[model samples]
Target chain A: MADINAIAKQFTDFYYQTFDTNRAGLQNLYRESSMLTWEGAPIQSAAAITEKLTSLPFEKVQHKVTTLDAQPSNPAVASILVIVTGLLVVDDSPSPLQFSQAFQLIPEGSSYYVLNDIFRLNYG
Target chain B: MADINAIAKQFTDFYYQTFDTNRAGLQNLYRESSMLTWEGAPIQSAAAITEKLTSLPFEKVQHKVTTLDAQPSNPAVASILVIVTGLLVVDDSPSPLQFSQAFQLIPEGSSYYVLNDIFRLNYG
Candidate 1:
């Protein structure tokens, strides 16, 4: 059996690192069928997702993950649900914003890609 | 205009209070159509949900919410998506576990009910 926990942690670490350093590089992590509910709006397609990422209000951001949990879907499907809680600092903000993000990752080839993702900040 | 932020905060506060003091009171917050993906298993119906809640591994638990965010669904639907990050202390454990929970709440009468909920701990 694969070490799903370690894989989840590594994926989260790599995902956020790429998110901060190379936003465009995140392209490889999604497919055309991927769906994202960002804050409140639903966005589809890899291209549109990438567009939304590039248009984020913050110019610089850092994610400090405190908790990462993974659960594998039943019926032996090669999919996992990952939940994350972390603090995010955007553009040298004095106070870090708290965030909770969830991702449904599906296996493809040698790696996994996000099938569905939902993200929201803790406060308005 | 209703202050969605305040409403979200109040909802969260009320939720954890009920969860800690009176788990049975949570029955008012769910209906026959409610669905929950807890940890990794899929559970449906109010009766089953309550049964599962009563059978939790820990006897006592406390939730400390750090972040709560809400987004009303589009098309003027009386539905909102709520994301929460918090800590959970179970059974006198010295260390607390990190938790992330998401709920799709739909308005029915004077209050809202959970339509879909997902919860996961951030570790194995």
Candidate 2:
């Protein structure tokens, strides 16, 4: 029996850490078929998604995760579905903004890669 | 190739309609292995999810979808990952609350069933 909870925990920890520190490194976590939707704008493919993510205006940011939920969405494919809600502060901003994200992770060899990712800032 | 966009559009419309009108009826769209995380609380299985949903405080509510994004997460399994952001007015309240939900739908026979669902109201 695969421990999905443990995998999800590890993945999220690495994900946010990489996102906050070395965003360009995050590209390895996706594949050519991967898709990302950030703030209602869709970006396809790993390279494009990485480019868009690394192009965010702020030079530095920090993510504080509030909640993490995971489910084995497709056991046959060893796919884990994860949802996250958190607060993020960009640069020296006085306040943090709330955001939510969902990820579909599929196994690739020993590790996993994001097949689908969607992110949204809580407010308009 | 499956028309994921069309499928997602139909599913979201049906889901919001059922949620607003007959929450209990949403059970047909789920299976025994389904999992739901509602506002950070985890609920396992379909029956429990429907129960918790029907037990929500508000009697009447309306959902206005703002954005809908879907990706073919697992092509082999025909799994579609959907993310939705919307506003909901509860019990004739003048103010509408923002919400976000993610669903992983897998085909079972002719239709689909929700394997994983996570929902949160965008507020404190």
Candidate 3:
């Protein structure tokens, strides 16, 4: 009874906006109880997520989604693959970082959020 | 164009047969260049795969597939979620091991081979 495609689009749009200035619009995309786990930071809460985002001086950020696979008729869930490229504004020099992330989406009612995201700093 | 469904079944059948006292019928399923990587042994060749199976004594092995979601009409590839439940025939006692594996299927004509299988020994 849910629109998974619409939910997936909204979830991706939030990530796209996060690059504008640190994680400017990231918080709005997740539920208050959202959980984030990664290498350096195994698990984090929504507040921690926001804190980590603005910790870096990012001049500009861009992301490219490689794959978006959704199960048929499963409006509440989807799997997404993203390649994030960002520039760190530090020491008056810009250094870029590339990341690949696999996201698990969960939709509640008309709104959708990310449940789990496994990411790695890709070098290859 | 190959049938992805058939290929996946064959791959699973080979794994099921490998638990019969030894790898009785595993060689026929894999290509000569199959690469196997796990925690204990990072990478292993076909010979190594065969050796690992027979190294342990087993009266029987059984597997249950939980999810089998495949790309439509893409017979050459599919992503499978398998729960392999097996008994280890050590000390003449049957100890069950449950494994969750994500398999990457590669089909060469009528025969299908596994390109990658990432598995973890699940506890819980």
Top candidate when judged by lDDT against the true structure = 2
lDDT of each model, Cα atoms only? 0.76, 0.86, 0.44
Interface RMSD of each: 6.5, 1.9, 13.6
Candidate 2 chain A lowest-lDDT run of ten: A1-10
Which ranges in model 1 have alpha carbons more than 4 Å from their true place? Answer: B1-99, B102-124
In candidate 2, clashing pairs total 0
For each candidate, the DockQ is 0.15, 0.65, 0.04
Q: Clashing residue pairs in candidate 3, if any?
A: none
lDDT of 3 by residue, A46-124 (tens): 6766666666455555555433322221212333222122222334444444343434454457555654444444332
The TM-score of candidate 3 is 0.40
lDDT of 2 by residue, B1-124 (tens): 2488789999999999999999899999888889898887888888999898989998999998888878877767787889888889999898899888899898888999998898978763
TM-score of 2: 0.89
DockQ score for model 1: 0.15
Candidate 3 lDDT tens digits, B4-79? 4455556666665564534645655555555444422433456666666556444454554433322221212333
Give the CAPRI class of candidate 2: medium
Task: State how far residue A109 of model 1 sits from its true place (Å).
Answer: 1.0
Which portions of model 3 miss their true places by more than 4 Å?
A1-7, A71-96, B1-124
In what order do the candidates fall by TM-score, top score first?
2, 1, 3
